[model samples]
Target: MAKDQTTRICCIGAGYVGTCTSAVLAYKNPSVRITVVDTSEAKIGAWRSRSFPISEPCLQEILKQVVERLAFSTDIEAAINAADLIFICVDTPTVTKGTGEGFALDTSAVVACVAKIVEVSTSDKIIVPCGTADQLRKLITQKNTKGLNFEVLSNPEFLAEGTAIHDLLHPDRVIIGAENTPKGSNAAARLVSLYQAWIPSDRIKTTNTWSSELGKLAANAMLAQRISSINSLTAICESVGADIQDISQIVGLDHRIGPHMLQASIGFGGSCFEKDIRCLVYLAESLGFRHIARYWMADLEMNDFQKASQTERITSLLGPLASSKLTIAVLGFSFKAGTTDVRSTPVLTIVRDLVGRGHKVKIFDPKAKKEDIQETLCKANLGRERAIVSLNAMQACDGAHVIAIATAWDEFRTRPGLRRMDWKSIADGMQQPRLMFDGCNVVDAKYLEGLGMKVLELGRKQAML
Candidate 1:
């Protein structure tokens, strides 16, 4: 393709990564025509309508600006037929069964996408996996029968859910990994040109595909390890009556131990952290690095332990759930605030344990859809009536004996805004011996206690009232 010609880009799998990347790419490079295609008509339909399937801050505004150059469709072949470059943005979820079950990412979807591209593509195409392994080149080489040239490149995305748009617009760095050959370098440079539209050339790093793939896994693994390490310290803090926040502040001051992902909370929850760490674990174990695999595997064990300990703490305080028959209000469900994704939310573990013990649990989240919450519960075999979804925090807290702040949302705190939760009003409506559990530590513990409510914040010790 000539530099003068408008680049035609096709992104397979119009899920979060594909949609966001395509929208931002089109917004930055107006000359490029990008079509995001998915097999799911519902997802494509949602993209076309006012009600988008996924939610991210500033995404809608950016999508609105690039509407002229960006398009969404269900026709994979047609998009591939027209595209000069195709990005495989399909989901590579952790495999549940068979070989490598519970640890390895199932790349079957990516493999199928390669076969489809090989079958439909007529011209030389640059194939980039937004997040994939290094085996793509071998797969394409074995499958391509039309004598068409396919250049496989690895360009993994590293955008956090809550601040995805900002991360994309002002990324710390952009990595493009390709083969060391001339064709591979040219393909990498072509991809770099698209990013150079907005990103500074110095911020973009070019490397071999293997390192790029391993780098993503290593990064996520280290992050999860840090979170687990902090959470583990929070447990010791609670035992010794030392505030984890203060401990974190002191430790973070050290230049060697910077402060990021060090804030104490219920536990880390999302799609990436656990999945990526497990992938690293599987890779380590497969190569006979048993000790290394166990080290990474311990992080996951610690996360689970943290969640279970929190549930046990709450249950112990509330007494036997069968005899109590208390109404427990749970605030926040979307793992973390600013996004509506609940793949591996840690709070659900607490909710399920409470409900199983016969407690009435009412839940509310600012951004999570009620239906999605119901679906997640139903999949876990917890009936809709088992855990009622409240319309708002007030509704969830009404007539409740205890309130638990699960997700760290800005509205949950006493900020100077209309959205700030009125704790006094909520406390007035609660049953006697009112107790509040702060999982994310987003509340003013002193103020809440003054309202005759017992506050139990994680990583902090308080005398029994």
Candidate 2:
């Protein structure tokens, strides 16, 4: 395979990574044919009809442009047989049963895909496994009945939930890892050429197989640690009556610290941070590094503690939850802005506690689907009786004693060309002694206080009581 040549690419698993990657490749390299295969017919159907399963900015627009070159289907075997290169983008979620129950990654889906490829593939192909590189190589080598040569490569994706399209189009850096053999170098160069179509040559990095795999895990761990560190300081700030935002500004000013993930909020969430941290913890523990495991494990513990502490503070302010049947309005349901991913979101913890204590909770998000929110809550064993989904923020805030800003969306803040939320109208409709818990610290607390709403902001002293 050479650059500028039309190569058939098959991506196994039409989830977030697979779909976004296939679309970008198809858009950048129009001559190359790419097909995304998944077992879920509904997901494939949704893509075919332009009804995307997940919400991401600029994703649909790019998908529309590459519709002629990119295809979604349920026929995995046929796509595998016809492809010269295959990408294993299947989900490797943390195992929830048997061995490695909570922390270790479960790569069963990837294992199954390997079995199918080994049975159906008839030609030499470059296999890019996104997870468990060593296990994937072992599985393919053991199951190969025919004399077909397979070159295994580790090409893990580094995509953030909301900015996936931009990350794909102009990634900061791309890591491709393969064996240090002649064939491995050749395969790495071929994939590099595909990315070079749009990405600058300097942005792509090639390394050994283990570094690529570990790099993905370590990158998420580092980001999650920053979030936990800032949150841990928020507790001290509350005790000392010092503002966390001020501290963040001063600390982030340091050239070494920078100002990326230093914002103090309720906690970090989404599919990556907590899951990847746990995987790292498990990896350390498995290697007999007890101290190392404990250090990484604290990041996850601090995240949970931050969420629980915020819920406790809100509930304590309401007196006894059993005595007061207060109506609370939750402003956001998704993990963060620009995406509708509810996995491991902190809002779930707060709302679950409120509803379980007999308080009514009304939730709203700009882009999160009502069904997705309901499903997430239901999976957590949270009943829907006291937890309701509102059509708009106004409906949720009406007759509510407290308004909780869970997700920090740009619309919630005052931005140019965007109409700010009508807090005066919302405050007027809310019940007396109205309170606003700015979990994300997006709005101006002083401004909200002027509207006669008591503001309780995270990482700040409680003085507006």
Candidate 3:
């Protein structure tokens, strides 16, 4: 593969992964023309807009650098036709219905993209499953491609939502899975050459198709398991009146464990962790690894218990939920900070539990859109009436007996205005004595207590005074 060759690259689905990966690739490889295609015109338009849909610190600068080279469009066919390499970065959301309901990937869009490639492509194109498993790609290729000849490769992404651009620019490794066939090997090499512009050759790992697909799931499962493990410790820590953060710090100091996903919170909440773990468990069950499935299933069980435990604590703090319509202010809806993504947020679980127990909830998030919160809550079976969305933190906290910080958004921690407006002001404006539940432990419990509010913190004992 020539470095200066006009290799056209098309990535289907201008999502968090696709947009970040395409922008970085175009930034790194100036010779390549990267076109990102998505079904949602709004998403594509956002990619082309001044404020990108997703918020990453260096993403906008990188996108600006490759603005000329990178393109976002809804014209999937045209992008596919003009491409040497087509990356199917479409969503493989967990199946909500049918055989593998609530666990398996809904590969309808991926299959559709593959079928479209088979139907429209004029030349020998290299098709890469950019966001999914190699098994899915093989299944799609086998089912859709009869006469069509295309090289299908697996190039799964491991970019975290808030820090996607950074992850893409400096990835740990670029794993490319290719078949033993000449076309497959050529396709893998072509993909590798593009990454080699920025990434060193040593970091580019090559393996058989199955390993590559399974590796993505395995990595996520392991990460989620770590979170679950720490969360499991949180329950024990609370029971024993021990500090989980201190324990985590000590545990992380060990060379064997190290520090990564050791921060304990309400629970693990993201699109990947829970979904991938569920998929892995399902995959194990399907393969007759019942014991293995049960083992992995415990991770998910622990996660659910972790989140549910918070809700139970909230109820315990509030007391007599049936007797009162509790006005609870929830800060931060996104799973984590620095991004507007609300998929599988722990806040939803808290909100649902509160609402189910006849509590009135008012939610506020700095980055999350009102529609996203409404949609997420509705999907969780808690509606708009049950959960009121507020634009500002003050408004969300207004007249509320309790303020719960579900996400560790930077704004929630460092904003002086929020800190200065202490419990006295909040209590004076509320129906009852104010309470603050720091689910993320972003606030100072003593400071809040000084202002005459009850402070409940995760991973730390509540001050008896």
Residue 290 alpha-carbon offset, candidate 2, angstroms: 0.8
Better candidate by lDDT, 2 or 3: 2
lDDT of 1 at 137: 76
Q: After superposing candidate 2, which stretches have Cα over 4 Å from the reference?
A: 1-6, 319-322, 414-419
If ranked by lDDT, best first, what sequence of candidates would result?
A: 1, 2, 3
How would you encode candidate 2's per-residue C-alpha lDDT over 33-109 as one tens digit per residue?
A: 99999999999999888888988889888888887889999999999988989999988889999887899999898
All models: lDDT? Answer: 0.88, 0.87, 0.82
lDDT of 3 by residue, 73-152 (tens): 99988999898888888878899999888888777888888878877877667888744545555655665545656778
Give the TM-score (vs. native) of candidate 1: 0.97
TM-score of each: 0.97, 0.96, 0.93
Q: Mind sharing the TM-score for model 2?
A: 0.96
Clashing pairs in 3: none
What is the overall TM-score of model 3 with all chains considered together? 0.93
Question: What's the distance in Å from true for residue 456, model 2?
Answer: 0.6
